[model samples]
Target: MRRPRSAVWLALRRNPVFYVAGLLVAVLIVMAAAPGLFTDADPSRCRLGLSREGPAEGAPFGYNLQGCDLYARTVYGARASVVVGVCATAAVVLLGGMIGMTAGYFGGWVDAVLSRVTDVFFGVPLLLGALVVLVAFPSGAAASPWETTAKVVLALAVLGWTTAARIMRAAVIQVKNTDYVNAALSLGSGHGRILTRHVLPNAVAPVLAWATIAVGTFIAVEATLSFVGIGLQPPVISWGTEISDAQAYVRQSPHMLVFPSAFLSVTVLAFVMLGDAVRTAMDPRERRA
Candidate 1:
């Protein structure tokens, strides 16, 4: 008998956290795709006449010190946050997954060398490593916004992959010893084929959950870099840059800080909840509970 097609959807529907995460992703996609449709004002262009204006009829989120519409900027900023989060997560999954799977499946000197490299990364805190990279390559030196984004993505990716690598390595090690994997090996399959076709498929579930969590971490990292004045430069709107710009006037014009912080918090929370949901759904232990 075939399983019900709606099984996964039914499971997801039973989890409110999953629903909220889906909603957040949808909102972010809309914000990223058509930021201008949400607001008339350009995020980069400043209106001298309306500088530092509080939230009003047209400007619900208010204007920044430079008089750029905060609402528009926040909406547009979603683009950077989501883009960086996704790209960084993909980088982590690809690079970390390959390194981990190779080490764990082979289980020899290969494992020792890769495991040591992973340990070295763990010894160095992720944020501190990212900060060092950002400082080394300032945003001002970038040729364009794309280049700046590339730098931020690379910095976060380098620091972020360690955890994923460790998690994936553990998963791969367990999967490599499973019945199907041994069967494949007994059948005289190539090591690469057994690892890729048999072991990786089963081992990837935990990595998927971890990758979801990594999205939130990357967003926070990008924001931290921007807050410290190293992330996405001017002419580009980012939640971190917006929040940083609002820090001085947080007391006087609370809207400046409030909106961006709220959005960033929501984005991070959404990803966290989503990661939990994925973990619960993917793990048989959690699902049985």
Candidate 2:
């Protein structure tokens, strides 16, 4: 008789989708960490003479209208996009998880108030909320890339936590009803200890899965904001900024738009696929399906 396989192992071995998505996401993580490995050319260095040039030896994707090497820019662009996605995801998960746990565990007026607040945020669309917040506190031209990234991440987390909170609240309510939680409570454990030591471990799985998906969502939103001319400013090398610059010269230099857009699409899809794989692995029902 064969022993039961672990969910993670089963997902990795049996699912082609998991493998493909994992591979792509890993590549992007590497790109974000060490962009110099992909290209030696400086992304910001440009020449008017080589502007809109097609593919050549050193630059595989050619040059943009601004004469910067498209290949280098695209490769380096991964850093900012991935950074914003990761930072925003972490913020949302922490903020949402706390609110969810408190509301779910208490189950009274506290729950009512928290739930209403979450509803208020939930009613505001992510992009729309982000636009308003970003406009109110716009990043200056001289702001560091990280400062600009932080501003965008803050905007996303402000409106994005409601879904995570809802998911975690539901999970906590279910988990808190279990025998183990009650036993811990009867044993004279403090509320904080019971919540952290017992309830959190089991209830956090769904939030983790959702956080994986949120990373991709945040990345796409950041790109949209940039494309609209309000996200990352000049001097920050990101796929979104590159794509925005390419739009004006689409007729003359299609490569400008194609390369960065492709990268952004692939990165977003990879995170989404990875999230699906994790969710499937965690849910036995999904495995059978």
Candidate No. with top TM-score: 2
lDDT of 1 by residue, 18-136 (tens): 98897997887788888877877778888888887998998899898899888989999999999999999999899899989888888899999999998898788877898898888
**For model 2, which pairs clash?**
none
**Model 2 misplacement above 4 A:** 1-5
- Model 2 per-residue lDDT tens digits across residues 1-289: 3322476567557878888999999999999999999999999899999999999999999998789999999999899999999999999999999999999999999999999999999999999999999999998767998888899999999899999999999999999999999998889999999988989988998999889889999999999999988888778888888888889989888998999999999999999999988887777677667
Q: How far in Å is the alpha carbon of 33 misplaced in model 1?
A: 2.3
What C-alpha lDDT does candidate 2 achieve relative to the native structure? 0.91
Q: Report lDDT (Cα) of residue 112, candidate 1.
A: 97
Residue 73, candidate 2: how far off, in angstroms? 0.4
- List the global CA lDDT of all models: 0.85, 0.91
